[model samples]
Target: MRSLHPLVVTPETAEVVELPAGGAFTLLADANHTGGALGANRLRVGPGRDGAKPHYHGLSTELFYVVDGAMEFLLGDRVETVAAGGLVVVPPRLPHAFGAVSGTGADLLAVLTPGVERFGYFRRLARVQHGLEPFDGLRSEQDRYDVHFVDAERWSSLRGGR
Candidate 1:
């Protein structure tokens, strides 16, 4: 069933998930909140922190809007730098990744369309990062989250080991 009324999330009411990789995510909405239409979250990463690895969604489009600082992204085979107020739209099956620059931090808004329940996925990632769970566990969950991890040697080479 879909919601007939609007849903609003304030900063104080947002759910915050701290990543073991040196950042935090403020979850604004998820599949349940949007009736599977979309999900939104704010990501804040410290300098030199990896936001995510190269991966592709099987069924959703990922849209990123940089709110502050700068973020370096691996969009398909290209490396691009998106600063504050910049936007990047990635279609399904297009491999991509992002992180804060070496000496600067970043703040961005990420939105996924055709929302899938991904809060659990993010939680699992935190567990993996904290050594509470093996990365193999996350590998098995890719299909469930629609996120398929991919090798990013090209991106690493371009970033000079970023």
Candidate 2:
């Protein structure tokens, strides 16, 4: 049974899950709502906040659109600074990570294609962020979420101790 209705997620109706990094992850249309076509969410980070550490999806491509402020992104071996109105698309298996540019807050919309039913992932992530659950608890679920964490030398050096 597939739902064919258009999905509408208003700000008030959307679920906002707070993260540990002075930020929040707003859950939007997920695979269940979109017939698995897309998974969407809003990621809002405070000044100098780190949104995600280096990781790559094994099955889903990711798209990020900076709606406000600036964001620093590590794509593969390069680090890019994208201002508001900027867009970055990452195909599956491409190492990537993001955070607010130093001293600035960042608001962005993130979408995953072939939606990965990731609401559970986001919720568990919040638990990890808030210390409700150890990161080790979430580590084993990465494969289920399609997110495979990996070390990126470039990202590590730049984000080290910061």
Candidates in order, TM-scores: namely 0.92, 0.94
Give lDDT tens digits, candidate 1, residues 9-79: 99899988887556788888888998888988899888877788889999999999999999999999998
Over 23-134, each residue of candidate 2 has an lDDT whose tens digit, in order, gives: 8999998889998889999999988877888899989999999999999999988999999999999999999999898899999999999898899999998888788989
Where model 1 places Cα greater than 4 Å from the true spot, the runs are: 159-162
Q: Give me the displacement of residue 38 in model 2, in angstroms.
A: 0.2
lDDT, residue 69, candidate 1: 92
Top model by TM-score, which number?
2
Clashes of 2: 0
Question: Model 2: residues >4 Å from true position, as ranges?
Answer: 1-3
Give the range where candidate 1 is weakest over 10 consecutive residues by summed lDDT: 153-162
lDDT of each: 0.88, 0.89
- The CA lDDT at 83 in model 2 is 98
Clashes (N, CA, C under 3 Å) per candidate: 0, 0
Model 2 / residue 58 / CA error / Å: 1.2
